[model samples]
Target chain A: MEPLFLEGKEDTPKIILNSQSNQYLISGRSLPEDATSFYSPVLKWLDEFSTQTVADPNVKFEVRLEYFNTASSKLLLDIFSKLEGLSENGKKVTVQWYYSEDDEDMLEAGEEYSELVDLKFEMKTY
Target chain B: MENNEILTKSMIYDLFKEMTKENITLLYQGDFSQNLMKAILGLTEKKMDNIEVSTNVKKKVFNVLVECVQNISKHSDESKEPPASKFTSILMLGSVNDQFIISTGNLIENKKVESFKSKILMINSLTSEGLKNLYKKIIVGHSLDEKGGIGLGLVHIARKTGEKFEYRFDKIDEQYSYFTLKVNISKIK
Candidate 1:
C-alpha cells in the first residue's frame, strides 16, 4: 500500500499515513464546513488498510487536533472504529493523543476515544 | 411618517450602535462558508492572542465558537431565494467586564423550534458532570445522521464553558423562525 499524506488547511487537519513505518499521524484544527466530505478519502484509505494488508501491521495513530467541530467529531469516531477493526484482527495498534498541557478538554477528548476503543492510548502533553 | 422599512433600519442601526458601544471584537451577518468560518476563527485566534486570558479559557472560547458556527452552517434554514453565500447566519463575539460572549443566529423551520428549545433546556439543566456523562453516553450510542453529527455540539459547549446556553426564537412567519444561541465564557473557564 502506498503512503497517504494530506497537508493541513485552516479548517482541516494534516494527515500522514506511512505504511512503511506503520505510523498514522493527524494534527491541527478540523473544522471543515463539510466534515463528511473532507474525511471521506481518509476513511476509504483506512478501510482498505485494515482489510487488505495480509500480515499484522504495527499500527500507531498520533492525533493532535487543536479543535474539531461536532460534525468532525463523528468522523473522528468513525476513524477510531475502523482502527478498532484493525486491532481486532490481532494487529498491534497504539495511539498517541497529544494536547497542550493547559487544554483539559482535549485531554478529555483523548480519554473519550480511549474508552470507546480497545487500543493503547498514550496521553502526551506538549 | 412611520414607514416599516425605516423603522427596521433604525432598529438595526440601534443594535449596531449598541454592539459597537459594547466593544464587540467581531460581528458578521451573512452567508457562511468553510472559508468564512476559517477566516472568523483566524481573526478570533489573533484577538485572543493579544488578550490576557488563560490558555484554557481561550481554548474553551475557540472550541465553543467553532461548534456554534458550524452548527448554524449545518442545520440552519437556507431555503431563502437568491441564496446568500451558502448558509445565512449571524456570528458575534464580544467581551463585557472580562467575560467573553459568543453568539450565533440563523433561520430554522418553525416546526423545529420546539425540539430545539427542549434540547437546549435539557442541556442547560445538567450539571457539568452530568453534561460530561451525557456527552459520553450520546457519543457511544448515537448515530450520525445525514448532517454528519451525533448531536454533541451543545453538550460539549455546555461542558466547556460551564454556562447555560441562552437562546431565543423569533417567529418570522408561519413557516420559519430566527434562532439565536448565546454562550458566555468566563475568564477562568
Candidate 2:
C-alpha cells in the first residue's frame, strides 16, 4: 500500500499513515476552516488500508496534537471509529495519546476518546 | 459633517482610551474570510506568546478564538445587497486580571434567533459532566451539516472554559438581528 503523508501547517496537522513502515501518526495543530475537506483524504486512506491484509499483527497509532478545534474533534472520532474496526478484525491496535504535562484538557480529551472507542489507549505525557 | 471630521481625532482618542480602560488587546470589525481567520489566529498566537502566558492558558484561548471566528465566518448572515458600513462582524480579545475574554458579533436572520438562543441556553444549563456526555453523544451520532458544522463548537467551548456563555441579540431590521457571544477563560488553572 502507498504511504500517506501530509505536511503540517500553521492550522493543519501532519498525517502519516504508512503501513509499509508501520508508522501511523497524526500530530500538530488542527483547526482548518473546512475540516471535513481536510480530513476526507485521511478517512479514505484509512478505508483503503483496512481492506488490505494486515502485515503486522500489532498497530500503534500515535496522536500528538497540540490543539484541534471541535470540527476536527468530530473527524478524530471518525478516525478512531475506523481504528476500532481494525481492532475487531483481529489486529492488535493501540492508540498512543501524547500531551504536554500541563495540558489537562488534552489529557481529558484522550480519556474521553478512550471511553468512546474500544481500542486500548496509552496516555503519555511529556 | 465633512468626511475628514466624521472620525475626529478627539473621537478616535476617546475610543482608544475606552479600549485601554477595557484592556482590549485586539479589536477588528469587518467581513471575515478564511484567510483573515488564519491571520487573526496567527496574530493572537504572537500576542499570547509575547505575554508569556502558560501553555495551557494559551491553548484554551486559541481554541475558543478559533471556534468563535469560524462561527462568524461560516454562519453569519449576509444581505442581498452590500450594507453601507461593510462591517458585518466584530471580534474583540481582551484580558482582565486572570481571565481572557473573547467576544464576537455577527448578523443573523431574525427567524433563527429563537432557536439559536435556545441552543445556547441548553448548553449553558449543562454541568461539566453533562456537557462532556452531550459532546460525546453528538460527536458519535451526529453528521456534519452542509457547512461542515456538527453543532458541537458551543458544547466544546462550554466544556473547555467551564463557564456559561454570555450572549445577546439586537434587532437590526425586520429580517435580521445582530448576535453577540462572549466567552471567558481563566488564566489560572
Candidate 3:
C-alpha cells in the first residue's frame, strides 16, 4: 500500500504512514472543526493497513501532539483501539507517545492512553 | 453630539470602577462564532504567555476556556419569544489572588436545565480518580451528540483543575434561562 502523508495546519495535525517503512507518525495540534471528517481518511488507511499481508509486519506508531481538543481525543482513542486490535492479531505493533518534559498534562494524557490500550507504549520526552 | 451618541462621563467612570472592583482581566459579551472564539483564545494565549506559570497550568486554563466557550456556542438556546439572534454569549477571564477564574454565560432552554445541573453536580461530586475513570469510560463508549459532546468537556475541566465548578441559572422569562459556569485554577501546585 502507498504511504499517506498529511500536512499539519493550525487546527490539524500532520499524519504520515509509510507501509514500506513500517513507520507511522501523528504530530502537531489537532483541533479540527469537524474532527470526524478530518480524521476519516487516516482511519481508513489504518483499516486497510490492518488487513494487508506485509512481509515483516512490524509497526511503530509515534504520536506527538502538542494540543488536541476533546473531539480529537476521542478519535485518538479510536486510533489506539484499532492498533490494539492489530496487535491482538499477532502483529508487532508498538506505540511511542512523545511530549515535552515540562508538559505534565500531555504526559498524563499519554499515561492514560497507555493504560487504556493493550499496545506496548514508550513514553518519550523531548 | 446627541445625548445617546455622546459619551457620558459618569457612565464611563462607573464602567471602569465596576471592572476594577470585579478584577476582570478580559471580558466579551456579544455574538460568539468560531472566528470570534479563535480570536478570544489567541488574546488569552498572548496574555497567559507573559504570566509566570507552568505549561501545565496554561494548558488547564486553555482547555477549560475552550470547553466553556464551546458549550455556550453550541448548546445555548437559539429560540426564544424575544428573538435573541441565537448566538449571543458572554465570557470573562479574571485573576484573584493566586488563582485564575474563567466564567461564561449564555441562554438555554428552561427544559434542559435540570439535566445540565444534575450532570454538573455529578461531576463536582466525583474525586479526581473517579473523574478519570469516568473520562475513560466516556472515551471508550464513544457516543457523542450532534455537537460532538458526550459531556467530555465538562469532565475534562473538572479533571484538569481538580477544582470545584461554580454554576448558576437565572430565569430570563418562561422559556429561556441564563446559565453561567465558572471554573477556578490555582497558579501554585
Candidate 4:
C-alpha cells in the first residue's frame, strides 16, 4: 500500500508516508482539531503496514514535529510502539527524528524515548 | 497599581510591552482549544515575518501551542484554589524585529518546571535522528508523565524553534507558580 499523506491545517499536522519508499513521515505541528479523527487513519495505515511487511523488510520513518497536544502525544506513543514491533520482528525499521537547531524540547523528547526503550534511534535536523 | 491605571492597560500595548496592531495578545479558556488554534493559524498566515517559515516550523509551533492550551482545559479540575483554577492562561504572539515569540503562561507546581527544563536541555543536545530514536524509546517504556506529553512535548518545543526554550517561574501563591514557555518561530527559507 502507498503511504498516507494529509495536508495540515492550523489545528493539525501534515502527514506523509510512502510505503514504497519505506520513508514514512509525520511532520508539522500536530494539535489536531479533533485528535481522534486525525490520528485514526495514520494509526490504521501503520497497522496495515505492519501486517503487510515482508520478512526481513527495511522500513524507514521520520517524525519531525515541534508541537502536539496531549491526546496526539498518546498517539505518538502508539506509533513508535508499532514501529518498534516491526523492528524487533527481523525488520530494519529506522526512525529519524528531526528538530530545529536549538530546540531543547524536541531533543529531550527524543532522549526520553531513548531512555524508555532499548532500541536505537536517529535524531537529525533539516 | 490603582484601578484607573489597570483600566487604562487594556489598550493593547498596555501590558508592559510595546505592541503593534499586528501583534496578538489574548487569553484562552473553556474547551475552545480548536477554535483558538484556528484563529491563531489565520493570524500567523496573514502576518508572515521577515524570515520564510518552512512547513516544518509552522507545524511545530502550531501543534505545540494547541497541546499546551488543551492541557490547561483538561487539568483545571485538579486546581485546589478556586480562583486560579478558573483562570486558564495567558497566551501571546508577538515579534521583535524578525523574531516571532510565542509565550504561554499556566499554573504548575515548582518541580514540574525543573523537570521541564531538564527535559528540554536533554533534547537540545541531540540530533534530529537521535530524537527520532528517543521518541520510540519513550513510547515502548511509557516514560511519559501522568499529566500529559510523552516527555517530548518540551523536546518538540526546542526542536521546532531552533532556539532555546526560554522559561520563567513566578510564585503565584504558597502552592503554585505561573510557568511561562517562550519560543521563536523563524520564517522558513
List of chain B TM-scores, one per candidate: 0.84, 0.91, 0.90, 0.68
Candidate 1 lDDT over residue span A60-80, tens digit each: 689988888777877888888
Off by over 4 Å in 3: A88-90, B5-10, B83-87
- Which segments of model 2 are wrong by more than 4 Å? B1-3, B81-87, B146-150
Which ten residues in a row are the worst by lDDT in model 2 chain B? B78-87
DockQ (C-alpha based) per candidate is 0.62, 0.71, 0.56, 0.26
Candidate 4 chain B least-lDDT 10 residues: B143-152
Model 3, CA-based lDDT: 0.84
If ranked by TM-score, best first, what sequence of candidates would result? 2, 3, 1, 4
In candidate 2, list every pair of residues with a backbone clash.
none
Write model 2 residue lDDT over B1-189, tens digit each, in one string: 556766777798898899999999888988677788889989988888888678998999889988888888888887664451344889999999989999998888889999999989999999999998988888888667622462588888898899999999988777788888999999887
How would you encode candidate 4's per-residue C-alpha lDDT over B1-189 as one tens digit per residue? 466764575764554454455555454444546676567666665654444665555555565556555555443223567645755566777766556677777777655667766776687687867665665555455643532552645554554555666777776666667777677766543
The sequence of per-residue lDDT tens digits that candidate 3 reaches over residues A34-117 is: 678888898899898888877776788999998888878888988998898887666888899999988888989999999998
Q: B30-83 in candidate 3: lDDT tens per residue?
A: 877767777888888899899998887887787777777777777777764565
Off by over 4 Å in 4: A1-30, A33-126, B1-17, B21-32, B49-60, B67-86, B110-114, B117-136, B143-150
Candidate 1: stretches off by over 4 Å: A52-57, B1-17, B78-88, B146-150
Computed on C-alpha atoms, the DockQ of candidate 2 is: 0.71
What fraction of correct interface contacts does each candidate retain? 0.71, 0.82, 0.44, 0.44
lDDT of 2 by residue, A18-91 (tens): 98899999999999888889999999998988887877869999999999998888889889999999866777
By DockQ, the best candidate is: 2
Q: Which candidate wins on TM-score?
A: 2
